[model samples]
Target: MKKIKTSPLLPQEFVVENISENEANIIAYPFEVGYAVSLAHPLRRFLLSSSQGYAPVAIKVEGAKHEFDSIRGMLEDISEFIINLKSIRFKLKNDETDAEVTYTFTGPKEIKGSDLSNEQVEIVTPDAFLATLNEDATLTFTLKIYQGIGFVPSEDIRDELDDGFIPLDAYFTPVRKATYEIDNVLVEDNPNFEKVIMNIVTDGQIGPVDAFKNALEVMYAQMAVFNSEISVAAPTTVERVDETPEIKKLMGRIEDLGLSARSFNCLDRSAVKFIGEIVMMSEADLKNVKNLGKKSYEEIVDKVAEYGFAVGADLSDEVVSAVKKKIEAE
Candidate 1:
């Protein structure tokens, strides 16, 4: 069998080649075709179904019913107009709670998405068709746009929504394109394969880097749920598990201490394992950590006290004596 060589995946595997206003191109090298293919679907689905975007979800129409009335622009019933509204991309300029815009049209001409613009809302897909009208047709209505992840059906909309607004089926996904390619495949006569390249393209709302970050966060959150249920003996190389009541009381992530990411990132592994060390560390000792400053140190002090833990508080003397005796016996 002939031998084939492939580049090993290193730190610089993922590279962004180009970025545009609404799109980005990225390449991940030294990837296997099987893993790349597996990653492609979830990434694409997450980009298209999970990413947040804007869409018009409600509309109140005037002078229209099941059948076209005497009005000229009432080419279709209210149902058709609602369908068209769902397709229009609406960008909410105001807070999500306050998402209402009024569009009044005395249609002497064709009505389009662009004509629905208000100070609080702008139609992104401006060329979208609404309805055609003759000289005397008139239509006036208010639209409510919402920001949410994934597609939510009209019936699922809660009763708390304001009266006169009906939820419509809308897909607010901003991802216009999501595709992956596997390239640079090399095979030997014996069917041994070498390297493969995978490329990803994403819409501008989120670049490839942020998209991957979001996807990873989603994946990590999912794994965290299942990780608690797994039961097995860990290898001996793992750190000794602390089973004492005092140690159990200290268990938690750094965020449990109320420190933000900026300050938490500066803490070493040892300090994180013994969270009380955060309060025990002196100003001079903490200042030595990269990027940790007086302001953050003060914040940590205040937050620790809020949690009823004092700065520099140590283990009880009785506990220490018990530990000393146990160690001496050992």
Candidate 2:
């Protein structure tokens, strides 16, 4: 299996199997998935290679809690930045005393030099930017996302607690730096017909297109009921019908292939009870499997809940009873 990290909200039975490297299909993929596949674009080359630009992020700097009554704070002063695509700001509050203060969402530039007057060129190459940080302080910085399709949704994916994204630890595998041979090709012969393709072999969530569409429907419904600020609006249409957009699937050239498979209630014994598997197969595996169809994919995928949990197998008697009670309480 090509190890790709799972999302925290990822369902249980996802795995990757036989794969091929080939062409891209121009389907209306989700925003997050689209962004991931867009990395093959030529535009990214400039962003990744650029030595002058900097990305901005906001963070907190809570000074030593032990020594000072007041904590000092500051906006990560990337005052010398070149590509000010965005800016992060801050305010200070005190004197420092604790062994070390913890900060969230901060960058090396955000830490104030102890002397407060230390002269440092805030804008430097990505390498230099990393080297300037004080070793003693806790830090967090903006991640450089390699987005293939830029859908800068101004929100983090929500979790059950509404606290934030699923922690990386929960994902079964980590994402690898998957590469694409051809990212963009013209969908139509028109001079301006543009199509971008990203090749990724997902640890697919089980279900058919119908299942996915249905799950999406319910997920969107709940999001609206709860008035979530970061929820995705219900898609007007998520079908592969005659009137659907003309997105084409282009096969890969080499050994890379893309085939999706999902199996439910497959396990005989399990701890949490629910068991299943969703696998992305290679061209070879795809050909050997019989009755692999779009409807099947939808059926499997539609079973995934917004909690990123999948419904399958059988719950333990105790577990089911507890779940029933929980639902009743809700």
- Candidate with the greatest lDDT versus the true structure: 1
Please provide, for model 2 over 56-150, each residue's C-alpha lDDT reduced to its tens digit, 9 standing for 90 to 100: 22222234221112222322233222112122211121321111122243323433322121122122112222213433434332222111111
**Candidate 1 structure quality by residue, lDDT tens digits, 1-330:** 523547322211455655564556655544444555566567666766766677766656665432223344567567777766666677676555347677777757778878877787766678888877667778777766777777877667646467656566766666666676655543211222223332344433345556656766766566576568886454233122334765444333356776776677667432443345554556567667777778877776787777656556676765444444332221
Which stretch of 10 consecutive residues in model 1 shows the poorest summed lDDT?
187-196
Alpha-carbon runs more than 4 Å astray in model 1: 1-11, 17-20, 65-72, 94-98, 158-163, 185-213, 226-330
> By summed lDDT, which 10 consecutive residues of candidate 2 come out lowest?
246-255
lDDT for model 2, please.
0.26
Per-residue lDDT of 215 in model 2: 31
Per-residue error at 118 for model 2, in Å? Answer: 60
